[model samples]
Target: MSEIALEARNLYKVFGRNPAQAVKRLKAGETRDDVLDVGTAAVIDASFAVQRGEIFVIMGLSGSGKSTIIRMLNGLHDITDGEVTIGGDPITGIPRGRLREIRRDRVSMVFQHFALLPHRTVADNVAYPLELRGVAKADRRARAEEILAMVGLAGWGDKLPSELSGGMQQRVGIARALAADTDILLMDEAFSALDPLIRREMQEQLVELQAKLQKTIVFITHDLNEAMFLGDRIAVMRDGRIVQIGTPEDILTDPANDYVEQFVQDVDRARVLTAGNVMERPRPYVPDTGGPRAALRQMKDAYSSAAYVTDRDRKLMGIVTDRDAVKLVRKGENSLRSILKPVPQSVSQDETLMNLFVPAVESPLPLAVTDEHDRLVGVIPRVTLLAALGPGPNATEEITLPMPPLPHAEIDAALGGAESAHEASANEVPTIKAPANEGEVR
Candidate 1:
């Protein structure tokens, strides 16, 4: 199957009698303002593709046409120009019956309001779509029960919408969409109506559910933070037009224009940047050659006091310091095993920088970055981490440092002080600060 699950091309939505003419004007290099006399352009020449199992968010403030673009995807709003396709099948200009079938079997939508039927049981509300398709009551009811459990409302199937809390009610809304068993999901402000705490919880729940379900989602929102937290890629819309589309880090570090720059100026960079974004190629690693002399030479070549020890397959074994390597050499040790020290800390490639502050500070050497199989992929030096945290146009720029050596005494003292401070306030989060001296190893 192709990777693209949904796509929109040159899409335009106009709300007036002469929408077709307005689109012509737009196509003729005339601005949206030029076509204002003909019709109101809701979405203008918006184009993007949503990969399978990806969360593609459309974000903009009110009247930016984000909502209109989403409606066009599933044929809720007629396209004034361009096309929309789901799973390689065009839905635009299709017969209403065929579109209905597509919506029933391949796409489902969840709205901002719970939209549950007030008089029906939660299970019935969820099973309504299946019921419309003439599914046997017993089968649809069972399916509803199963989906309810997946959304964390297992035993609440018997309760009415009126009897449930607002958050729980929204879960039913999601349950209903999932019960449809569609590969594509369109969520329009789905969590915007909940309380602040409840909204955050729902956002987290959606991410967890997406992991298990792997549904291709088109999430519409006005909140930049939500977009950063949830979207695999985001399309930023302005008045009736898409201005930029990129990953959260791309949007943050390289805004396309002043409008986008202003939008991301207040975003918390720590949460958006992951280890993979800032990590550099791992260097000066000894390939478990079983020789302390080899380890020392590698350290010296990299201008460092320490180096990682990895097996032939690049699976990280441990680290070796120059001092330890020298001791092993003097003691006539042939193997690096005696001198190997367990890496002080390691982080997965996807770990956010916010969670790495303490680990980066505690490590004597650059923090190891590993993949699922524990193979060393890269390293995150303290200097690089500090650079990423600093404010400037180059805040997110990658920095490469020659692995400079730190004296064993200084390394021990820094680690000891960090560990002590960490133990003193286990509940408080540590903040990032620049070192007093640029030459000092972070």
Candidate 2:
């Protein structure tokens, strides 16, 4: 199956008379203001692809056309001049019967106001979509109960919407959408109406649900922080046009324009940037066979007091200091095992800098970054960590201390020399691979 679950191409939504003519003017050299006499262009030439099981957030201030764009995606609002596809099927110009089928079986929506049927019980409200589809009463009720449990509503399914809190009602709305068993979920400011704490709680619940369900989600919001917290990739809209689309770190570190720069001026960089963003290539190190002589040489050449020891697969064994190396050499010992010190601390590449501050300060050496298999992938030097956390617009700038040679080449040469002297085996260390895009928010 194709990876993309939803797509919008050259989308335009013009409100007013003769919207078609307004689209033509927009395609031409005319600005939005120039076409004001004809119609208001709500969404102008918006284009984006949402991968399956991804959360794609459309964010902007009021009247930026974020909501308008979402409405057009599910055919709730007619597209002035554009196409929308769901699961590789074009839904823009299909017949109303086909569109309704797509809405019922492929797409589900959650609104901001928690549009629950007041008279019906919560379980009945969740089962309403299945009821419309002629599902058996027992089947739909069982499905409703299952979905209610998934969204943390559980036994509250029997209570009326009026008896539940605002947060509970919103959960019911989500439950209703999930009961449709749709591939795509369109949430239009689904949590904006709640109080601050409740909104945060809802956001957390949505993230947890997405982790389990992996639905293709197109979420609309006016809050920047919420967008950053929940969006796998955020499309920032301004004045009816999408200005930039990127991950949270990309938006914070490399904004596309002045508007976006100003828009993200107040964002907390430490929260958005992970260790992967700030870590550099691992420093020169000695192989396990290299011993104290090679370890001392590496520390001298790298102009450092310590050297890391790793196996052929780049799994870190321990660290050896120049002081320890000197003592071992004087004693005529060839192995570094005696003086090796255990790593003080280490962090995974996905750890955020906010959680790294205390460990980074407490570690005696550069912070070690490991992959899933415990192989050292990168290191965050003290200077690099400080620069990343310091106050500045460019939080992603690389800061490195002076070094003698390329890290990999120097280590390779040291290991080669050690193997020849000791008549031991040697192998080239693998470089760190870039992290894959997992369609996750962080």
Candidate 3:
């Protein structure tokens, strides 16, 4: 097997009464007849592995055992059966001292409540972890300040936890998690408790932090949007079992079963799949400014897909993939300056991956993403629409991302350079790899 960041094999967690007896009963083929008579099963025979630096999500409705699974990984709760490992060390049988060391040194968790010290300042709550580990107050505070700045709580260091809003308090929680400097981060509905706008903001900040930190994260949530938005691969759970695990697109388009289908029925799929997501390797193409012979050479190279046409500015103008190339050559039009489509349906960097389809289904050629000035960002294959849609969501998914304001001017420029000259927004580099590749897909 690959060297996973974390792994769970035949992991089983049961709550209330004699859990071992419950397991024995379960093994003996006893079934719970009713909710009142039978004890609840928080997690049942769950198994999956997480690769290093990957964001793995466990999602489902309330009481599905997502939280239990997270707790089991961190040693907060014991498993009734099976093994759980972090960086290859089995968590189940470790000594208490060693487990303490592991929790202090390897894993850090953020709860939805943002458990800060109400009496202490933002800086104190962050420093508390390091201090408990016996670091000097000065050293701990220094590290706390660093994390605060990282989580955008720079000036709020002196403010009491009670003084801050829910979003700000959650930020402190995140900063505290980073203070431990652990390889893995465990989030349990970290943003679900906040208001809509605040929750959106926190998710965006988390994305920004993840981009820079790349910590192996196992986040749990009941929100389908958060699961879809932040997960590298989502594990959809139902009644203490993982039903499916794959990229958001995979789960969305090719649902594992009926349960997954109802989950993504209404998602705006184009936003999830972008031209940037489905682009193949770029082949050399004749510039529109190039002469006729160069265009012919380019045409023959393409098996059939339309060849993208660009100007000296690399602004997309037209395509001559496959048959278009043959027809253009037959017409004796040798210059790209003539055959290119002057107007095409294109998306900008600021747009969501869900919009990648408008041009794909409408345009003869594959859709291309352009920058504010109409500079071709990339080409997305039409087939990617299928790839983005993925299997139909049979289970609920979550969406989480940093909240950045849309750039009206940049979008205007992409539509056609119709706006006044102004500063264009800088593209926020993706912190995590998109589902398909490490780079921005759309």
TM-score of each: 0.86, 0.86, 0.71
| Residue range 330-391, candidate 1, lDDT tens digits | 67776888768898788998899999988877776678888888878777777678677656
Q: Model 3: residues >4 Å from true position, as ranges?
A: 28-38, 268-271, 276-307, 310-352, 355-366, 369-442
Candidate 2 lDDT over 266-318, as tens digits, reads 77777778888888777646777777767766665556667678887888999
Kindly report which residue pairs in candidate 2 clash with one another. none
Q: Rank by lDDT, highest first.
A: 1, 2, 3
| Model 3 TM-score relative to the real fold | 0.71
lDDT of each: 0.84, 0.84, 0.71
RMSD to true structure for each model, in Å: 9.2, 5.8, 12.4
lDDT of 3 by residue, 126-208 (tens): 98879878999889988999899988888888999988988999999999999988999999999998999989888888888
The segments of candidate 1 whose C-alpha lies over 4 angstroms from its true place after superposition are 298-305, 392-442
